[model samples]
Target: MTDERTYWFDTMQRIASPVLHSLANETLHSDLPTETPPLKPSALLEAFGRTICGLGPWLGATDIPENEKAVQAEFLDLYYRGLANGMRPESQDYMPIVGDHQPLVDMAFLADGILRGGDRMIDDMPEDVQDDFLYALQLTAQIKPYESNWVLFSVLVEIMRWKLDDPAYSQQKIDTLLQKMMQWYRGDGIYGDGQNVHVDYYNSYVIHPLLVDAVTYYSDAYTRSIRDVVYQRAARYAATLERVISPEGTFPVLGRSITYRFGAFHALAQAAWQHNLPENVAPSQVRAALTAVIQRTITATDMFDANGWLNIGFYGNQPTMGEGYINHGSVYLCNTVFLPLGLPVSDPFWADPAKDWTAKAIYGNAPVPRDEPVNY
Candidate 1:
């Protein structure tokens, strides 16, 4: 790799390594409002599992200690227990909760056990555990009738492949979801989070890549036609987002939980990894811009305690304003910063430290003239 490329990889490694290292030490308290109000441990488990899975690559054998394995094992064991405790589906406001969120929890664990982290835990699952997971998927198919968030629904399709691989898991529902989700597309790689037209980076960072990944996982059956269209547009959108960083290396910081500002880089990272980055897009530039944003938002004194509990609020120590859903362990969702784990070391993009994006072009690159106001 050239010195220029090496710079970007080094910078990304720096920005991500600390967050992954912090995971083992982060305090996970369950008595907090995040767990008390809704009183559902599965959501917390899902959030925690996703965080761990997102950060796992960085935490591989060499980075994390062998001693920490027991801790992580216990953490996962508790989450699995929660899934076992309430395997049935529920509904809310006439919408199927299975389609809305519960399935997401089921899929999160399923992915945690099989697809995302590998199938190491597959054989270890008790017979009853395997049966409950199947029952959960059956419930997932039943709830597909009234759901609208195509992203969450798409997860079930991937989980089906990973869990059952059965041709009987409802291809019709998957097709319906793809059709509905495509309706949210406004071109240039953006998809509305759900109904309506509120546009933001979350769609770019979370929704698009997740859908694309789901598309890729089922490539054996679904033709490449659908995946190609979404990937091309997503890469283009990532290219446009490259211009969002200021010459000073700052983003607009325009959405909810500015704490999640760093999480926005996950989409760009995936684009680079997939080798689908736009022609005009430079991985080095995305790295430099993203590194700058992390430095600005994730202050050592504010974002985490000495013990590693991610402090609430965007800039300071204020857990009071966090959602009723943010518990001690939930804060580690911030580890979504390391979503670049999917990228292999052999990838040219990760071979170097970050380079500059703000040098040649001034401040007018990827300007969003107007941002949609999100209801807090």
Candidate 2:
């Protein structure tokens, strides 16, 4: 098999090996051994299940094989359990621990449900549940003065677009959300997740990637005026994220899920896919850099534990300071790390190793430069 095929297969196998095991024996909706743990609502347990379930079909899309039917079967079992127990069809139950996170939950369900689950999901959600879900989606329609973390908003937009089947379906909402998001960006490609520009991984993991996907989706449906603005902002974010990577190929593991480590590559790959990445922003270089990152933090034994949970933290076994409500499985959403799988294996960006600063200097190539930030 080609390297591309190898990557696709290896990634799927890695993800499914553990996930399939979890499905076979694990039960959902059990109370935490400790008090409510971070990331509230019993719904999240279900959401995690749905998210992994979504991954199976996506893996199958790449031809993982029918023998792997266990993946989807497990997804279906969890999804049904979620619908039957955790979710109430008539109520909107998406409250967050901090900042408004309902949209994230909504998008997660909608994206996983429609894109991956299809008829299975629709059937599982009774009519009342569907109506309630539509109501929950409408709740995300507001534009506010404060720039809350905009990643969830843009992600909601993608899910809405998928749900609505309109290329320009949620234009007004997208426009308003974008305008609000723009206020948080301090220029030179960096954006504060919300107000006051305290920096972290949001730029690489959420901000830049969401912008690229939302813009590309909207542009496909509407005029250049709408699309071009987002593209320009995305280009700048991509450039800045490139500079954040150290000469050693590591970016600072600051922010929420330091456990998520290389998960930020989703943003990098999205930005690259939206356009030809700048010479300074190397895709293969990023792939190699993040490979080092994933290797450093995750262990082969992470899949097996006394409690049957995966355990690896950004700062080793101990949990760090900023990880608010996240738990073990919540961290695995970091498996979103493989989201770049959406990019076809044949994409040229994946074909060659990117030249790092050392390579650039040695080979007489243009240096990858970082622009200083503008303090707001």
Candidate 3:
């Protein structure tokens, strides 16, 4: 872990520790900069989702190295305590319904956090807390997701429910949502944000990951077939994303949620995690591409506040980059970039020697292949 690689993991810990350490201990809202946001409760849920989902990969891992485990163990332990309190009827981080749709939006990521947070997030928790956690998730059932990407939030919550084996939700609910996403599919690995096409990364950030994960909970051939198609779509999408990285690691700052930062790569990183990257994209290449992006985004900027909670900007304290809905929690969506950490120390994504990313290879006079689109 020398030079670039060294800074990556070290910076990951450094940048990530403050948010996880603060939130897991129930002080994130206080310690974090909620400088603006007319809607605090909804903003709080946004913070919860962005932060927790970003950490999903590392927290969900089953084989964390002992040395690193010791490093994260304290914050990890406190996070469970924090999660338990978040569900309590009264707490600083208490969950709240935001309009008819917003709670479902944030709860999806809360469900995502529990799903990806691994045993420490759920199974290893004290029994009563686990029961309370399940009950807390159940309360989300009251909220309805608006059409569009919001649909996957409901699917995610139900998948968590199914994982709990609680059977609390009707299978039809999951089926209907999956069907809607498929309806939104625009072919060649792209799905419209919802009923209308939007120019953004929602397909990568939300749709693809949820599609890949939710489709797995069912055993039916139809579901399995959809998963296969999704993996294919994801592979192509990941490849496209790889090429989008500039030689210097920057990407287009288009569309909403630009404050989500590297979280824009959630689908791509999840593809790398599942070893499902397209055949044309080498695993090491994707790794290098993403590492560069992470370095460019997370390590190279004054992205954090004085206390280390993330600020609402892509690079620095540019509050104007955040939308009206944006808050401290919403920006933590950047954590999704860490999904590759779920790969084992031995996995090729981590183990492979670094290679030139597409942009670098081309600019450095190295041979690069022409990009192509797949019918899938």
lDDT of 3 by residue, 1-376 (tens): 1244455556667656765666567776676678753347766566666666766667767776665676556656756766666666567766666344667877788777666666666667777776776686677776777788888888888777777777676578888888898999887788888878788888777988888877754455467768888888888888888888988889999898888888899888888887888877887888888878887786546787777777878887788988877777777777777777767777877777888888889999998888866776
Candidate structures ordered by TM-score, highest first: 3, 1, 2
lDDT of 2 at 275: 46
Candidate 2 lDDT at 273 equals: 45
lDDT of 2 by residue, 2-114 (tens): 45435544654554344334332343334222224443553344335424433523442443345434654565564444433333442232222224554454344334424
Query: Candidate 2 — worst ten consecutive residues by lDDT sum?
Result: 89-98
Q: List the residue pairs that clash in candidate 3.
A: 47-329, 50-332, 54-335, 54-336
User: What TM-score do all the candidates reach, one by one?
Assistant: 0.68, 0.67, 0.92
Whole-model lDDT per candidate: 0.51, 0.49, 0.75
112 Cα displacement, candidate 2 (Å): 8.3
> Which ranges of candidate 3 are over 4 A from the true structure?
1-5, 37-39, 98-100, 217-221, 299-301
Report each candidate's C-alpha RMSD, comma-separated, in the order given.
7.6, 6.0, 2.1
> Across residues 175-238, which tens digit of lDDT does each residue of candidate 1 receive?
5566677777765567776666554456654566566666765554553557877787678666
Report the Cα lDDT for residue 78, model 1.
44
